[model samples]
Target: MAYMSGNPSNVSFVGAFLNTLGDRLFSAFNVAVEANGRMARVEALQALSDEQLAAKGLRREDIARHVFSDIFDV
Candidate 1:
């Protein structure tokens, strides 16, 4: 029934709270990077001409669908 700040057995509520906040921030950062990458893909696809798009079996309207195909059934 003893508590010490430096003791490994004693975990502070503040420390746990900060760790949870850090985890959420890191997760949000990762999601942002992923979204930016997807945006880059969209831009790259948009730069392609109709002929180029057809070569890949995609149309200009299908860019977003192609980019997020793995995540959505659309």
Candidate 2:
């Protein structure tokens, strides 16, 4: 008679599932944080006058694009 052990396989499956879940949760968190940061940046830039913005080398029209360029690859 032969006995088969299933403990190792079960543990491996649980570990893989947990790892994937953790990765997805982390990715979602990062996306939320990035969006919040981008919105804040846009608002702050919008509060600046044209002269002040130009002093910082930024244009009002490009605020959103500038803030989100990292994610958009633009």
Candidate 3:
């Protein structure tokens, strides 16, 4: 009795896994780009004067937290 049976199910499973992996990789890349954008925003904001930042309702100390506000609960 041959214990190994070539089946289409196995191929489908592999394909599905690869697709999921690719999606996850793309999502991660997008998140990285978004984070970088947030960092840049924070840097630009920091370069502004305190009065300017206050006008925008932002504080120097809150820059990082503000940038990641959408990503984190804080």
Listed in order, each prediction's TM-score against the native is 0.77, 0.73, 0.80
Please report how far candidate 3 places residue 74 from its true position, in Å: 1.7
lDDT per residue as tens, model 1, 1-74:
96565755445676888899999999999989999999999999999999999999999999999999987898
Pairs of residues clashing in candidate 1: none
| Candidate 2 Cα errors over 4 Å, as ranges | 1-7
Instruction: Give the alpha carbon lDDT tens digit for every residue of 1-74 in model 3.
Output: 65756787998999999999999999999989987988899889889999998998988898888888878888
Give the whole-model CA lDDT for all candidates, comma-separated.
0.92, 0.89, 0.89
Sorted on lDDT, best first, the list reads 1, 2, 3
Error of 1 at 23 (Å): 0.8
Higher-ranked by TM-score: 2 or 3: 3
lDDT of 2 by residue, 1-74 (tens): 98867788898999999999999999999989888987898999999999999998888898877888877876
lDDT of 2: 0.89
Better of 1 and 3 by lDDT: 1
Residue 35 lDDT in candidate 2: 83
Question: How does candidate 1 score on lDDT?
Answer: 0.92
